[model samples]
Target chain A: MDFGAMVDYLPLFEQAMWLTLRIGWIGILGSLVIGLVVAMITHYKIPVLYQISLFYIELYRNTPLLIQLFFMYFALPRVLGVGIDAEACGMLGLALLGGAYMAESFRSGLEAVEPIQTESALSLGMTKAQVMRYVVLPQAVSLSVQSFVANIIFLLKETSVFSAISLMDLMFVAKDLIGLYYNTTECLVLLVIFYLIIILPVSILGTVVERKLRYGAFGS
Target chain B: MELLGLDVLFKGSNAMRLLQGLGVAVEISIISVVISLVLGMLFGIFMTWKNPVARVISRIYLEIVRIMPQLVLLFIVFFGATRALGLNVSAELSSIIVFSFWGVGEMGDLVRGSLESIPVHQYESAAALGMTKGQIYYHVVIPQAVRRLIPMSINLVTRMIKTTSLILMIGVVEVMKVGQQIIEANRMVSPNAVFGIYGTILLLYFLVCWPISMLARHLEKKWSN
Candidate 1:
């Protein structure tokens, strides 16, 4: 249990951390775009799609995310007649699952925007798209910051499950290293610290954004 | 093998798989929730103890639990802790330990909230009634607090069941993992079965979780009334 033993795996763990961040960035960005579109379409109260997306969100939100990851890895390729690599499967699974949650968060933010804001903007000679782009989204994004951040932390954690599918995510590296070395405790301890380093800054940023929203700087 | 349309739901084999998955998911949820509730109550009670030693330990425990992810905690227990301690832990046993320990922290926080949310006079009046401390807790504080606790605890149950899927990462044959194996086995001939099976798995989760969610809502309304 010497503390110095952890330092031996430092370079490999750093490479793993970089991979996790890369996956997180791609997954989070893709989901945000997809979620925002889905959320807005649902928010506008589209005829059939509104009900459909509602059902989708309900199904995704209630299930365990690890289940979703495995489902994607094993299922999607067969259905679509495509050969998806492990990374693609993992990322896509994460986005779909996380997108559903993000849609809910964005919708909460969208709902918080009073109808009056749009009405006033329309009265001020703004087009619907223009009003949404310039006025609604900025505020909604800011307002949803806390839920969004929490969901991201959640997404990061669930990424570990992608290891079950042989994705080269951070936890996979740790698990694989432990298998080779039989240093499960040390490897996992390093993994936890690596996550905390990434996560703590996000938490602090979320709090700051929340405070800004509460004051005059953010939401109206 | 990919199931398209609503016809797959009517298939006997598919339907049975759904039912089986639902059962395991529900069993895991119920066990973890009960374990956590008991542990959480104990931790909550520990929070109120006079000993600074107990209070500090509880505080440290809860903070660590809160900061740590459930998946990481699962890994720590199943992979790291058991190995380090030379313990041969079963997957289900490890899942229970990981979830319940996390639940204690969560439930403790909820308990603290319910306890603090009660007005001070309730406690003072109970004390003034010539009742003992145990009587005050059992008769006065707990019954009222139980109302608020029910809905919150129900939410925790939903979370626990959902989190239980992480057990599959350690090779426990849970619903999702079962679906994965089924899809993989069938993928060569039954191309469509992938989405079909996974979709069924998702719906099974929905069935298990939705009822509890409705119950939580029902409790909240009943208690508020």
Candidate 2:
């Protein structure tokens, strides 16, 4: 274990961590927005589109993001005759996979809300769209906040997989440093701490939000 | 490029690719699941039982498995484990071990949930009936726990199967890995065909997982009765 070289790679690892966070948050938010929209569309059964939303969520959820990422990286070049950069490719992959899980979480939350609330809103002369926008989405989003956060953490951890197709994330940096220095012990130790530094806050934030939600439920 | 065509899956060679992918996926999933279930059950029992040593060990194992990312674990098991062991352990075997450790901790938590969910009254009734501890566990406790356990375990199995695609990172030629090679080799000819190839691969995973997921849901509903 070369403690000294590991020390030198500290800055590289730090930069990688920052990039990972930036790309991951972008992917997470993008997916959440898309997922919520699709979830709403499906939750109301939206006339004849129930199966489409159901199909979309299922298709994305079951596949590994690695293959999805590959599709974005390798497949698009020929079909569209345009190539995307690695960062964009990574975002697309993560969003596709993450969006699926989020839709389910949001849909379940929407379904979990009592039907009477929707009926009351309907009887109050609110249109379906208005009822959904004002009454349903807010409740579902809030109710699903914990699962959403946990899902984000899960996405963040999985971002490492993007390294395979040359996404310059933290794991890539870790792998590069290990290959360069051949100090497996020291490099991996830094990598683990590097992961913890990012993931720990996420874990804490998720728990606190969940606790708050639980407490609020009891108070009400 | 043409790999996305439906005929590719039916053609002998392409069919072989599909079967190979299916074989690796199921093999790794089954191997990991069996090991994980046994490991999980033991840890679950220890966690529920009043044993100090077992309690501490199980907690630590759970935290480590939960916190460590799957990719890093695979990296360690694939590259580092072989180095550490001084043996030529293949990536596939390493994947099984790594997934087993991960799967076991998750399964153990589910088992723990099922065990604790077994009401205290059930135990007391068994005791009143003059059943021994082992008898109570086998006759009264395990049967009820099995219902909850089955659904969650199956769900975990699907999860493990989907995740085994990650093993491709370490050069495991599962479905995803095979798809990558096909796309790369054909990239010059078809361009952007990787999407369709991957899309098909994604569908293949759904095919593998969806029925099991349905079965899990069915079990949950059935057992709830």
Best by TM-score: 2
Full-model lDDT for every candidate: 0.78, 0.80
Candidate 1 residue runs with Cα over 4 Å from true position: A2-5, A113-143, A216-220, B1-22, B42-59, B113-149, B177-196, B217-225
TM-score of chain A in every predicted structure: 0.89, 0.91
TM-score for each of the candidates = 0.80, 0.89
lDDT of 1 at B119: 85
* Candidate No. with top lDDT: 2
Candidate 2 TM-score, true structure as reference: 0.89
Docking class of 2: medium
Candidate 2 DockQ vs. native = 0.54
The most accurate candidate by DockQ is: 2
lDDT of 2 by residue, A57-119 (tens): 877777778767776686657567688988888887788788898998898778766777789
Across B1-225, the per-residue lDDT of candidate 2 in tens digits comes to: 354433334434765785687689889989999999998898777778778888888888877776778998887776676666777879889899899999989998899999999999999999999999999999999999999899989989988988888887788788776766665665576544456667678677878899998899899989886
